[model samples]
Target: MNDIRLYAIGEVARRTGLSVSAIRFYSDEGIVAPADVTAAGHRLYDVHAIARLEFVGTLRELDAGLDDIRRLLEGRVTLSDLATAHLSRLDDQARRIRSRRAVLRTIARQHTEAEQVILMHKLAGMSDDERDRLFDDFWNEISEGLEVSPEFLGLMRNGRLVLPDEPATEQLEAWIELANLLQDAGFRREVKEALHETFSSPGAAIMTSTEMVGVFERGGAILVRAQEAQRSGAPADSPLGREIAGLYSAHMGEITEIPDSPEYRAKLAADVLGIEQMYLESLEEAATSTDPYTRYQSLVAIIDGTAREAAEFMPFAWLSSALKAVASLKDS
Candidate 1:
């Protein structure tokens, strides 16, 4: 009997490296069935049972429910699906943790649960749709007689914050803070007024919101790149050898009067390209980094891109409603 592969419960536990109680639990849960019973009514296990128990143990550790284990054992789900589902759930939990952390931080600052909850809700990031709706309403309120363009509307829509529904703890916190910032009456008013400056300069400014926004975004990108490259031993006069600098110059001065001379263009390009390189790096690195300012960075990028278009509409809101579609946005 000792030499035989089949064994009684005690022998099976000894050979499989499982405790008797664990084996019994698996049996009760229908995860592992006993092999043919011995003549003395003792529980016996087949060689297959040993493998099954090991698989079940692994699944349990991975947080699979008993039902999931049963379905898996029955081949109801593929391994890939099982792994994806587990990972997705884990991501959701991580987002919740981030949200909670933000709330806790708020609580810490204010030292009151009531205050924290209030702050948390405002700080929470809104969906793209929510942000769009907010802007839409705000325009409707204050965009009377404004000459908003379709392209301008598109820029605004694109700039809307669309944080992932399930974000990391830090992301959640970032969302909260950003939302709170936007929600601030003073901040919103300042932003609105700041926007007004772009359009108020004079009649026939020779630009739309889209063109304006694109210009600033391009210019900022160039500035970021140039700044970083200069720091990394690339001289300001570094021949525009990198595509980043060339692109920055080409696109930046396209809409603005930064001069068309090759030498001057190259310098402007290098200076601005440096800025863009750094800013884009920040955007790319955001997904994996635990930085609490992810939301802020994204918002800045979007705003940078939209600066020109925003400038176009800053001046007029009571002359014409040709841009009524874009002239509607709600106040925070």
Candidate 2:
């Protein structure tokens, strides 16, 4: 005990690389107390206190709150516990930074109005529950008063936008866009009108609304392949393009219980291409058209971490062109 070395505040600062004032602050906060007081009323820290100060400085640099450090030093929480807790906080901070960056980038790119900028920022900061409710409202509004079965309604509601805890910039942007799109009255009206036509028109008798929606969801894989083929720059009349067109032809035929024929293929192409169409006949059209609905599906794909499968209009446009070519060739 007699040989034990004690360090004055200045010496402790030199050894721990902490400012003298910081050391005094820690001491006052009871994070690292002085070992003894000199007769002249000077505070002195022992080697153990110096080590504690060093650790305290490290934690502070890591952005740990003083209360957390106090808990750690007081043995209320283990070092591993402190690290785990701080890691969670760091992750939260990172997510916030990413969200802010996304908002700023969107504003710069769009030259967004002040009101819209506020809305986008608020959308980025929405809680999980708020986001869920937003999605629910979208589905509910679209399906309201429709004769669709409960199962079909449930399917509509099931396509939720779940942003990961650590979302990328693109994902955050997609979420904001999706939120805005869902809130758009024009978008909602279009979707509701399409759903109404699907269920109330003569086509509803051929296949239940539930079955039709199922076909759309199930045909996603085929559309994915068509998109891939289109991206390879294959002309609409090329073999690969024709093959994809045939796949869609068969899928649509199966859905409608009508065999594939030149006449039917021609009509399918026309309906999906929005030519002489009373309502949306294909999910391809709904999700790959020039309308806001297409943007909605693209954003959904991004938020779902399936951006690679997100379909743009060109692919489906190429597809419709191929369908038309096949029909014309068959008739010739």
Candidate 3:
């Protein structure tokens, strides 16, 4: 009868592979009760105790604390409820892991403990309202004195600061930088005032925020030639030069003019070169600044319209998202 398999605490630990102290801990916590006690008060157990210990180990690995484990062992909480909470926690941990990975990618090297702390705090702390407030401050500063439409005001109102989910290192770094920029009140106010000034100042960029009833055309002959070269494998110099020249041509079409003439081509070349000057200035402002609104406005002015443009500029994904928000609120 003794060799057949009822085991003592030491035997249970040996077979289940739990340490003696851990088994004792579980017993004390009421997670794994003794199957029986000896006449001398030693904990004697049968094989059923081994099964209970196995269940205890499974719950602990899932981060189920002792109280929850005991509740489960006593049949107080359903397995379904436990599983749901455990999975949710795992998903949250995965998101944090991804954010950390992004910080690592941005640094392009290993991070110090201090960097980890700062990066995590910035990337993880803000709620959506907080992020929106940062953008609000920027637009108010930039649109100062400008005759922006209510529609345009709405655009600024609806701008959302998008932080990446499963962030890459670059995204995490960008997020940290963005958060720090938003913290300064004076900087945001300055951004709004500057934006108001830009919209008031210029030949373009402020063309009704959607300058239309104006022509919409692509760059002419030069652009065509450049596009052809892309197919012909010509030196990128000639080809890219043509494409760059096309930008002004496209604007000309939008403005109801076509710059197909050689003289116009020369002017277009000058204009493109002019764009470089703005780019340089924008680079300087962004690098030396602490205001998100200002950085975004500069980015909008310097960058071209493309996929990359949406990320840096005002949230140009359009009224659709905001419109959706309004619709949702109205219906609710």
Per-candidate Cα RMSD to the true structure, in Å, reads 12.6, 8.0, 12.3
The models' CA-based lDDT, in order, is: 0.57, 0.79, 0.56
TM-score on alpha carbons, each prediction = 0.61, 0.65, 0.56
Clashes (backbone N, CA, C under 3 Å), per candidate, total 44, 0, 10
lDDT of 3 by residue, 49-99 (tens): 887888778788778878777777788988888888778888888877766
Model 1: lowest-lDDT 10 consecutive positions: 314-323
Q: Taking the tens digit of each residue's C-alpha lDDT, what string does model 1 give over 116-195?
A: 58657655534567766665655444344446555664554444455556554445555565566555666555555545
lDDT of 2 by residue, 1-332 (tens): 35388878888888899999998898888888999989997889988888888888998998899999998888999999999988998888898999999999899889689999999999999998999999888887887898866766665555567888888899998888788888999989997887787679766644556666678776776777767777787788888777778888888889779977899989878776673132224444554666655667767777877654443333556778889989855532
How far residue 183's Cα lies from its native spot in candidate 2, in Å, is: 1.4
| Candidate no. 2 TM-score | 0.65
Residue 240 in model 1: lDDT:
37
What's the lDDT for candidate 2?
Answer: 0.79
Ranking by lDDT: 2, 1, 3
